[model samples]
Target: MPESTRERGRVEASRGGSVRLEDVAVRFRTKKKDVTALRDVSLDVAEGEFVAIVGPSGCGKSTLLKLVAGLLKPSSGAVRLRGEPVTGPRHDIGYVFQRAALLEWRSARRNILLQAEMRRMPADRARARTAELIAMTGLTGFEDAYPHELSGGMQQRVALCRALLHEPPVLLMDEPFGALDALTREQLNVELNRIWRETRTTVLLVTHSIAEAAYLADRIVVMTDRPGTVAEVIDVGLPDERDYAVTMARPEFARATARIRDLLGAASAAD
Candidate 1:
C-alpha cells in the first residue's frame, strides 16, 4: 500500500479504483468436471500503491487479476470497486497483457487512439491524449510506426501508453514484459518504475519473475498452488525512489528477493 492510503486500511483496493478481492473463490465448470482455480483469495491494493502477485504456475494469478477486472465472477466471494459489485467489464480499470496485442495495420498513434475510440471519447480530446501518450512513452518519432517496425520493448511501451491513454486510476498488468529478452526486460523495469511514479496509478502486476516483482512492486503477494490462496504478502521495504542498478544493490532489496524466494520454495516443497 502507498503511504497515502495506509491509514485507510486497504479500503481503496477493495472498494474503489483501488482494487480489492474478498475471500474470492472461482470454479470453472468444464466439460469433464469442475475445477476450482482459486479459493479464499483475498487481497487489497491501496490507492496509488503497486502490488505484485508471484507464485508457481497454475496458481490462479491471472484468475485473481480477472476478478478485479470484472472479467470473471467469483462463485463464493465478492469483488468490489468504489463499494459497488463488479459484475461486468469496467472502463475505469486498464489491462495490459503479456503480448502487446496491437493491431498489425495500425500505427502506434492510431493503436493508442483505439482506446479512445472504443470508449467513444471526443476526437479532439483523443488526439490530445494520443500526443501526450506518445511523448510520455517515448514513441514521439515512431507515432507513425507500425508494430513490426518497433522492437519488443518499444511495442510494449506503446501497449502501455494505450493502457494509460485514459489515465485509469488502477492498472492491471499480466506479465506485460514476460515475452521480452532479459536486457530489454531490465530496461523496461526501470522505465516502468518511473512511469508508475509519474502516473501515480494504482498497479497490480502478476509476474513469474521474483526479481522483477521485487524491483517494481511496493508489496509482493505470494500465492499457493492449485486452489490458489494468499500465501503471504511481503512489503518491499526498500526506498520508493528506486533505480535499476542502485536499487538492486541495496541490502533491503536482497533481503526481499531472498525472502520471497524462500517462501516460494517452501510453498513448492509443501506441494
Candidate 2:
C-alpha cells in the first residue's frame, strides 16, 4: 500500500531520517484459527511531531503503539526508527502506559531515577535530571512520597518525568490519562502541552478520547476498526499557544474535534 500524503510529509520532514512501516500486518495464530489485529498498516512519523492515534475499542491502536515501541513485531512488514529497522526496544524511545506503574517501594524521585540507573547514566547526572524532572512535572515537594501516598494525577506526572529523564527523542504514550477523573485529565492536558513545547520531544499518543486527541495532538490519526487502518489524519487548526480557557472555546477547536469524532464514528460503523 502507498503512504498517504500526511505520512509522506512526515517521512520527508525527517530529512532522510524517518520511521517507516511498510505493509505492516499482525496476526495471531492459534490452534484453531488466525486472528488479525492490524492489516496493511503503513505510517511514517517525522523527527519532531505530536501524533495522536484514535480508534474504537479493539481497533489495534495499542498494538500499533507497541509495534513502534518494539514490544511487538508485525507478522508481516517492518518497523523502523530513524532510518534503522527497529528489531527490538530502542533506547531512544520512552513508553508510558495507562497506569503510572510506579514501584510501591520506591519514592517518587527514586522511581524517576530507575530508568536512568538502568541505562547506567552517571549518578550525579541522574540525580540532577531526576530533580529537574520533578520540578518540571510539579512534583517537587512530593519527591519523597510513595505511590500509595500520591493521587492518580501525581503518579502519572512522575511517570511522565521518568519517561523524559533520559531525554529520549521519541515518547510513546498509551492512554496515560484515561483513568484520571475529568478535572485531573484536563489539568494534565494543559501540563502536557507545556512540557511538550519545552522539551520539543516527538510524541505519539494513543487514546480513545476525541477531546483528548484534539486537545493534545498536532495531528490526529483516526484508525479504522479491528484489522485497523488509517482512516484520516486531521491537523488541529488551534494555535500552538494553547490554554484551556482560550483554546477550548475557540471555534476552530470545536471543528477539529467534531471532524475527528465523525471520522471515528464512520470507521466504527464500517467495522
Candidate 3:
C-alpha cells in the first residue's frame, strides 16, 4: 500500500462514528436461570483508534469483544460495525485470545498461513502478506520453528500474524499478552503499538493491566462489575509514536492508570 493511503487509513472519528454499540445488553440462559452478563452498555470505537476495555473479573470484558465479532447476540439494544448492525459472525474482523492457540504441528509461518487457507486467499498474495507480517512482528528468524520450539511471546506473535493476515479493518484482542511474563508482556505491548501504527487497523483490547491499557490505547473504557456497564471512558491523549519507558513516566500515563485502578477497585468493592 502507498504511504498516503496508509496515512488516510489512520483517520479518527467522533464517538458513535465508527464501531457503534447502542444500549447493548447480553443475557445467558441456563436450565435454572437467565443470567445477565452485560446491561445497557453503549460504546463507540473510532476508526483506527486503539481502545482498551478494563473491568473487574466477570464484567464480561471478553463478552464485549464477542459481541463485536458477532460471536454472540445481544439480548437488548444493538451492536454495529461501521454503520451496519452485526447480525452474525463477522469475517472482516480479526480476533486474538490470551492463549496463542497455535497448531502444535504447524511451523510459525504455516500457522499464520492457516488464515489464508480458511479464507482461500491467492497463494502468492497470502505468502507475501505472511512474509510482511513476519518481518513487521519480528518473527523473521523463527518462521520455520514449531510452536513448542518458540517461547510463549513468540507463539503469541505467530497468533497476531495469523490474525492480521487478512488485514482486517478492525482487530479484537482478548488479553493477547496477558499470559506472558512481565518482561515479555511489556515487550509485546511496545511491538503491538508499533504494529497498530504501521497497519492503521482499529483495535479493541480487553485487558486487566492498567499500565497496559494506559500505554497502548487512545481511549480506555472502564466498566463496572458483573452485568457490565461502562463506568467511564478516558482519553489517553498520548502521541501515536510512543517510547515505552518515556510513556510510562509521563503524567498522562500516571493519571490514566490511577483513574483506571480506582475505578476497578470501586467495582471490586461493589462486587
Candidate 4:
C-alpha cells in the first residue's frame, strides 16, 4: 500500500517554530453526509515568522488559521502551540478579520481598550500600551476619533491596534485589508509589515492577493482546492525592512509571486 497522505505531510517543529500541525484534517457532518474541509495538512511555522497562506476561494485557508487560534478542532491529528495541543479558544492570540468591526459608540482609544478591559489589565498599563500602539501605528492624532469619523484604512488601523493591545504572541489576520481600495490596501500592507517587524509576533495571514502575500510574508504557503492540502511553500527572499517600490522591483519578488501564481493555476486546473 502507498504511504498515507497524512504520513507524507506530517512535519515536526524541529526549529522550535511554536506552531505545528501534524497530519491534520477537518470534517463537518451534516445530516446528509460528512464533508471534509481539510486533509493531511501539516505545517510548521517558526517563532516570529511572518507566513502568508494563499489559495483559491474555499480552500480552507481561513480554517487553518482558526485551528491555530484554537477556535476549531481537528477531526484527526493535532495542532500544537509551544508543543502543547490546542484544545480550546486561545486567549493568547489576536485575530483581525477583513472588516474592522469597531463598535459604533467607541472612540478609537476606547475601542482598543476593549481588549484590555476584557483581560482586566490595569487601567494605567492598558492606557500606556494603547498610547504606544497608537503612536506606532500612526494613529496618534486620531485616538479620539470615532470609527464613522475615520477612513477605511484608519478604521482598520484601529482594529489592528485593538488586536495588539493585549500583546499576544501570535497574530492571525484574515484579509484585514481586503475591503480597502488598492492604494489604501497597499499602504496598509506596508504598515502591517512594519508592525510585524516591531512586534516580532508570529503572523499567519490569509489573503487572496498574490502580490500582498509575496510582499508581506517570509514564506508563502500555497494550497489546493477544497479538502485543501499544502501544494508548496515558497520562500519570499526579501529583507525584513522592505521599501514598497524597491522590494516590488526586485527579481526575487517577481519570482516568488510568479511561482505562487503558477502553483495556484495548476491547483485550480487540477481541480
Query: Could you say which candidate leads in lDDT?
Result: 3
Candidate 1 Cα outliers beyond 4 Å, as residue runs = 1-17
RMSD to native, candidate 3:
4.5
Pull out the clashing pairs in model 3.
none
Is candidate 2 or 3 superior in TM-score? 3
lDDT of 4: 0.89
- The 0-to-1 C-alpha lDDT of every candidate, in the order given, reads 0.86, 0.84, 0.91, 0.89
Clashes found in each candidate (C-alpha, N, C closer than 3 A): 6, 0, 0, 0
lDDT, candidate 1, 1-271, per-residue tens: 2333353233444434466678899999999999999998877667788899999999999998888888888999889765667899877988999999999999998998899999999999989988887887778899999999999999999999999999998899999999999999998888889888888888899999999999998889988888888888888876666878898998878988898898889989998
**Model 2 lDDT-worst window of ten:** 1-10
Best by TM-score: 3
Candidate 1 pairs with clashing backbones: 13-18, 13-19, 13-20, 14-20, 15-82, 16-82
Residue 14, model 4: lDDT of: 50
Candidate 3 TM-score to native: 0.94
lDDT of 3 by residue, 21-126 (tens): 9899999999999889999888877788889999988999999999999999999999999777899999999999999999999999999999999999999999
Those runs of model 4 whose alpha carbons end farther than 4 Å from true positions after fitting are: 1-15
Model 2, global lDDT? 0.84
